[model samples]
Structure formats: structure tokens, C-alpha cells
Target: MNERLLLDHLLVRGPASRADLAKITGLSKPTVSAALAGMEDSGLVHLAGEVLGRPGPVTSLYDVTAGAAHIGAVDIGRDWIRVAVADLRGRFVGRKDGRNAAKNSEDLVSRVRELAQAAAGQAGLPWTSVITAVVGSPGVYDKDADRMIFAPNLPGWEGSGLGDRLRTALGVDVTIENDINLAALGEHAYGAGHGIANFALVSIGTGVGMGIVVNGELYVGARGAAGEVSFLPAPEPVPADDDTLRHGLTESLAAAPGVVRAARAAGLHLDTAKEVFTAAAEGDPAALEVVHAEGRRIGGLIVAVASVLDPELVVLTGGVGHNLALLGDAITSRFAELGPLRPRVVASTLGDSGVLLGAVARALSQAWDHIFDLRQSGVQPRQSGVQYGMSR
Candidate 1:
């Protein structure tokens, strides 16, 4: 208990003297002194010189030694793979980004391993040093089947023994989470949703999905598929046989291909959502019309989410969703027309960093749990805790 208190104080207050720790933690001076002695002897903390301020004799200051151990995080997208290694404090020590050129599950697995190794090496550590790793993936991970489901963007990802392959390659317990879920968690932990108890993140890009946070926790329903909003019905019934419908009905209309389709049908002849947005920015009538249509569709989906969950805030993200300068007003206008209970809709501040940051947050949480368990069980800690960059 004393150890945990001291560590928690140091984590929140940075390096502190024994007197400061005692005062902050409400512990006796001898207790703080004893705890610090044990912690320093265990290599969990180190002297950082003396604390200055108050009038008494200078008191020694100590801080968590950050180089004790590390964790890893990966964001696996259809076009890119990003990997990062962070110390126990959750500060990223090394990072690597690579294109996803793999044609099959085996190739993808190998690529992830390669990227993880590269990140670990850059952190001056071996692969085995990564205590835990979390991977942010594009679909719902069915743990019972150990495969990814609902991942039309990634063919053959389901039932591909990906979980086992990742475990074998990394030699550590690997956690796979839906990318959108990670994004919501990221926003809650670090970005727009910070301190907000209830919020939803709707991501519209190559696909459409949402991550819901209710009362300070992620609401992943049964089968880990609660946020799969792609199947929601839209005004224009996308043909069931349409290839884009593979992801879902709403997705086919609110996502990138849908945007491109709208642009082309409007005589714009655009090839990508980026082009559509660019054209819209230039006041192209066709492109603007398409974007307005998509905003209404996306707004309808958000209304559905609000009517049901009524989150405190709604965050828009992804290649198309983050185009707030172009789509924000349209979405708000449509929402106003549709309902009386509209939450504030905003764009993600983290941009593309949400998924990877969320992964690292989870990894750090897991690693710290392991360390705390070891400490409670009387096991000498490999390394203690520290407050890294970007406070969690």
C-alpha cells in the first residue's frame, strides 16, 4: 500500500522528495522514507537531486527510472501499418510506419513482426523486451474464433489464425481491438472527448463505423460489434449486390466510395474523396452538392445514435469526416432539421494519431497492471512506473 501510494504520487506529481510524498499521500514521514528506500533499492526510482523551496534542510528528490521496461502498440490499416514502442511511463521511445504491401495473412503477419522489431530496436531493446502489445484493427475481433469478422477492407482476415500468428511472432500476449473503438478511447483519453463522460466517434472514410463511450466506459455490446453502424439503413437503399455494400448499407452511402459515386453521378467526375473535398473547396457545384448529400446521410446516422444513446458529444473523424471546414455546417444543418436533441458535433483533434495512441494507452495500462501484480506478490519489479509524455 505504501509503495503504491508513493508510486501513484510520483506518477501524478513527478519527482518528489520524501517529505513531499508524505504530505501528498497522507503518510507518515517514516513510512514514506521506508517506502522510498525499498523503491530506490528495487531500481524502481532514482535520486534526481534535492528538492528546494521550503526553509528546512534540503530534502532528497527521487523519480521513477523510465528505462525499466517497455510496451508496444500497432495500428493495422488497409494501406499502412504503424508501430510504436513506449516505456512503462507510456512515453513513445521509438516508432515505425510502413506500407501494407502484404497480399495474404501470412505476409501481413510477417510485416507486423518486422515493423514491431524495427520499433523495438529503435528503442534500444530486443523483441522480448516488449512486455505487452495492443493491435488496433479494422474489424470486430471474435476471440472465440480467433479471427477478424466484418473486415471487407481486408480480404481473408477472418479465420486466418491471425491471433495465433501474432502471438507466435511476438512471443507475448497480443490484444486486438476494433480500430474505431480504439479511436473513441483515444479521444476520451487524449483528445476531443477528454473529461467528457459520454461521447461517440463516427469515422467516415473507406468505411463507416462508430465507437461509443457511455458513462466513462466503452459500450461494446454482445459479440463486440455494438459500434458497427455500417448496417444501418439509409434513405437510398444500396443494392444488396453492390460490392460496396459488403461493409454495410449506411457505409456504402456515407463512406469514400459513396462520396466518389455521388460526385461522379453529379457530373463532377471525381476519383477520390480528397478530390471531392478539393473541388468543393473551390466552390464546384457538383462536388458541393455531393458533400451536402453525404452530410445529411451522416447526420441521419448521428441522429439515430443520439436518439438511442444520447452521448454528450459526437466526434467526426476519418479522411472525409475530418473535413470539417467543408462538411461541418452541412451535418449540423441536417441534424437541426432532423431533431431537437442534437449533441455538439466536432472534428477529431488527434487526426490520424488516435488509433495508435489508444493502442499505446491500453498497452501501458496492461503493463502497469502486470507490474503492480508482481509488486503486490512480493516479486522484485523489473522496473517501476513513471509518468511519460502525454499524461494518461
Candidate 2:
């Protein structure tokens, strides 16, 4: 208990001497000394440096061994796959980003494995050495079904036994989560939503989704589908086609593809949403109109979220949603046209790295828990808890 308490302090506040640890942790100096010695012998803490010109004897500072264990974070998106290896301190030691050209779930699994190995290699460690890994994808992982659901952007990703296959491929403990949810966590941990207790992250890209944070913790609903906002009803008439049914109305009308579709309808001749946004930035009237319409759609979505969540802020992210400068006016106008409720909105500062950073943050927490459990059980830290397991 003393060791864990001291270790937690060190992890949060950097290095501290035995006297300081005792003062902060409210333990006796002798108890702090014993705990630090035990942790040092276990390779979990190390003497960082000594304060030279102190009043009495030299005060030796100790810190958690950040490199004692490593964690892996993966972000799987429609257009890209990002992998990062981070130490116990949540600092990325190695990272790799690659274009995703996967045609099937099998290919995607293989690609993720390759990227994990490559990232681990860059960190001068083997992939097996990673204590835990968190994968951020675009669907709700159904533990009972052992497969992803509500993910239409990735082909063949909803197949049964998908979770097992990913574990087999990655050869480590893995947790699959919604990419947008992870982005919210990223913002809460390191970006725009930092220090805010209640906020929502709405991502408009290849697909539309939201992540909710309440009371400083993520709320994923009863079945982990809390923020699947794509299915919400829209003002625009939605087609009764199979594709529309699969992706839902709000996503079909508000996502990047929808932006491009509106741009083409406005005679902009743009193929991608990026192109449409670029044209709008270059002051094309047609493109601007399309963008404003898209923004209004997003604004409607935000209003719906605020009515229920009443979050302190709503962070807009993803490829199309990040253009808050262009979307702000239309969003505000739509807010006026709608009811009286208007939530604070801003663009995501984390960019494409949000999911990856969130994954790292979660993996670090898991690694710490595993380490503590092993230590309490009198087992070697690296012997168990390295195999595949779903995070609940």
C-alpha cells in the first residue's frame, strides 16, 4: 500500500525524495524509505538525481521507471491507420502512420499487426513487450457477439469472431473502441475539452458519430452505443434504400460524402469533401452555399445532443467538421432558427492524432492497473496479463 501510494504520487508529480514522498503521502519517513527501496529493487522506481546544496545530507530524488513497461495505441480509420508505442508516462516513443487500403477485415487485421510490429521496432522493443494495447475503430464492439456493429465505412469489419481474429493477429491484450469516443477522451485528456466535466465530441467525416463525457468520465450507454448519433432523424427526406438504412439519415446527409454530394449538386465539380472545402476557402459562392448547408445540418445535430446531454461544450472534429471558421456562421444561424438553446462549440485541436492519443492514455491506465495487480499478487509483472482480452 505504501509503495503503491508513493508510486502514484511519483507518476503524477514527477520525481520526489523520500522525505518529500513521506510528507506528501502522509507516511512515516522510514516507511517511505522501505517502500522506495522495494520499488527500486523491483525496477519500478529509480533514483533520478540528487539535490546538491540542500540543508542537510544530499536528498536523493526518485521517479517512476517510465520505460519499465510500454503500451500500444492504434487508430483505424477509413483513409488511414496510425500506430504508436508509448511508455508508462503516456509519451509516445515511436509512431507510424500509413494509408489504409484494406478491402476486407482480414487485410485490415494483417495491416494493423504489421504497423504494431513496425512501431514497436522503432521503439527498440519487441511487440510482445507491450503490456497492453487499445484500438480505436469506427464501430461499437459487441462483446457478446464478439464483432463490431454499426460500422458501414469499413467493409467486412462486422463479421463474427472479428475480435478473436484481431487478438490473434496482434498477439497481445487488446481493447477495441469507437474512434469518435476515443477522440473525445483525447480532447478531455490533452486537447480542447481539458478540465471540462461535461462535453461532447461530434465527428463529421466518412461517418457521423459523437462521444459523450459526463462527470469527467466517458458514458457509453447500456450497450456501448451511447453516441451513435448517425441514426438521428433529419429534416431532409431520406431515401428508403438499403445503404441509407445501413448508415442512417443524419450520417448520409451530414458526413463528408454528403458534403461532396451537395457540392456536386451545386455544380462545384468537386470529387472529395476536401476539394469542396478548398473551393469554398478560395471564395466560390456555390461551394460556400453547400458548406453552409452542411453546417446547418451539423448545427441541428448539436442541438439534439445538447437537449439531452446539456454538455458544457461541444467539440467539432473530423475532416469536414474541423472547418469551424467556415461553419460557425451557419451553425449559429441554424441555432437561432431552431429553439433557444445554444451550446458552446469549437474545433478540435488534436487533429488526426486524437484517437491515437486517447488510445495511449487508456492503454497507460490499463498497464498501470496490470502492474499493480501483479505486484499485489506476488507475480512477475511481465509473466501474465500480456495475452488477449477485451476491456469492459
Highest TM-score scorer:
2
True-structure Cα RMSD, model 1: 3.8
lDDT score for residue 303 of model 2: 92
Best by lDDT: 2
- Over the stretch 1-392, how does candidate 2's per-residue lDDT look in tens digits? 78888988998899999989888988999999998887787678999999998688998999988888889999999999999999888899988899899999999999999999999999998888788889999989998999999998998999999889988998878889989989999999999999999999999989999999999999999999999999998769878699998998999999999888888888878799999989989999999999999989998999999999999999999999999999999999999999988999999999899999899878888888887776776764334443322211
**What is the lDDT, from 0 to 100, of the residue 141 in candidate 2?**
95
State, as a TM-score between 0 and 1, how close model 1 is to the true structure: 0.93
Candidate 1, 1-392: lDDT as tens digits:
78877887787678888878888888999999998898787677889898578698988999887666678889888888899898767788988999998888888889999999999888888867777889998899988789999898875777667899999988777999999999899898889999999999999988888999999988899889998999888778677886756688888888998899888888887789999999999998888888888888887888999999989999999999999888878778988899697888999999778888888878877876776666676666434333221111
Tell me the spans in candidate 2 whose CA falls farther than 4 Å from its real position: 380-392
**Each model's TM-score, in the order given?**
0.93, 0.96
